[model samples]
Target: MNGYHILLVEDDSMIGDLLQKMLVREGYQVTWEKDGENVLDIIHQIDLVIMDIMLPGEDGYQVTKKIKNAGLNIPIIFLSARNDIDSKLQGLTIGEDYMIKPFDPRELLLRMKKMLENQYGTFTQIKHVFIDAEHKKVFHRSLHQEVAFTAIERKIFFYLYENRDRTLTKEHFFDYLWQLEDRNPNIVNVHIKKIREKIHDHTGEIIQNIYGEGYRLNTHMKK
Candidate 1:
């Protein structure tokens, strides 16, 4: 956890800086590359890669192919703005995960943790619902394609998944995600509603509102 080295391939200075800072805070050594050229040069030192799709000269797909062709086995997570199914499918074939842009910091952290631990095993199976944490995606057979979730939605889903048996109050999420003790916590309600709709947990919403005590993932939910 502390000594892990990650090569970050992102061209946008602002996004790259924020991601680097967050990963460093989580105790990982990050060697950031703006373009796709130097990635091959430094892949030997990296334990995992968090790459952006739209890079300088070469896109993520090309760079990933190069790395794989060279026989460097590494977990690559694609963090890009391309939310299309085609893009997701193609990236997933080469990389470990394909995350859409405007991602939650916590989701990225969790995926990175999972990818780093992939040598041991993957996350526990949650039935049909595939939590593509590395990709920051969530989907099931009911939805033929991936259900896009915003940064907040991913945070909510991941939190509920981790603590599936427990009820989480709005204040809990507000404090944990937003890192603030807010005055109006109804925004949490809005997010919960959206997550339910996107994932298609209608009659028995996977996220059940506790009427008075916030919400929790319904244990009765399908496998």
Candidate 2:
């Protein structure tokens, strides 16, 4: 598997730099974003985002909410100094994984790695083939059905079907699509929404949301 692309959104330069370095040393591509204003613009470039709840302007909660509402399936890990239950719950409500600040950088990396691994793993053998990268297409032999997919929809399906039964982080998807470059999360959201629609149209089973982690492909054969 390829290394993950990470978005480190922290206002504190020291913390951000430390995390960035750690992630880099671990062989993952890291993009450090200190400003909240530009976060939305580049949300699509990374596989996952390590966000600080206390940002300069918009803050992490608001950012997370926007990402989810936009239909992006990228996983967010909240790294904040606030350890209160309410804060944690709020972060979770917005579909982000939470981590308290003054935390070990190594631990953060481990959590991120685990989260990505869970979402994007390995593929299973099913008779579906000929996926349209721009349009989601799934051909099932048993059902004798063929479905069309949107661009983003196709990417998600291709990623999942290629790595079925595994956890895939938003970071992983971004890396696959944009490599290690920095971009916007909104781009990811656009693709995820399209992909979800295509999946529901054909399979009828909603792509499993790992909750604060990312998305997963349910390999259980549908009847």
Best-matching candidate per lDDT: 1
RMSD, every candidate, angstroms: 17.4, 17.4
Error of 1 at 32 (Å): 0.5
lDDT of 1 by residue, 141-210 (tens): 3222467888778888888877887999877787778874454767888888888887677753567788
Give the Cα lDDT of each candidate. Answer: 0.79, 0.69
Residue 210 lDDT in candidate 2: 80
lDDT of 2 by residue, 20-54 (tens): 77787776667798866877787776668888888
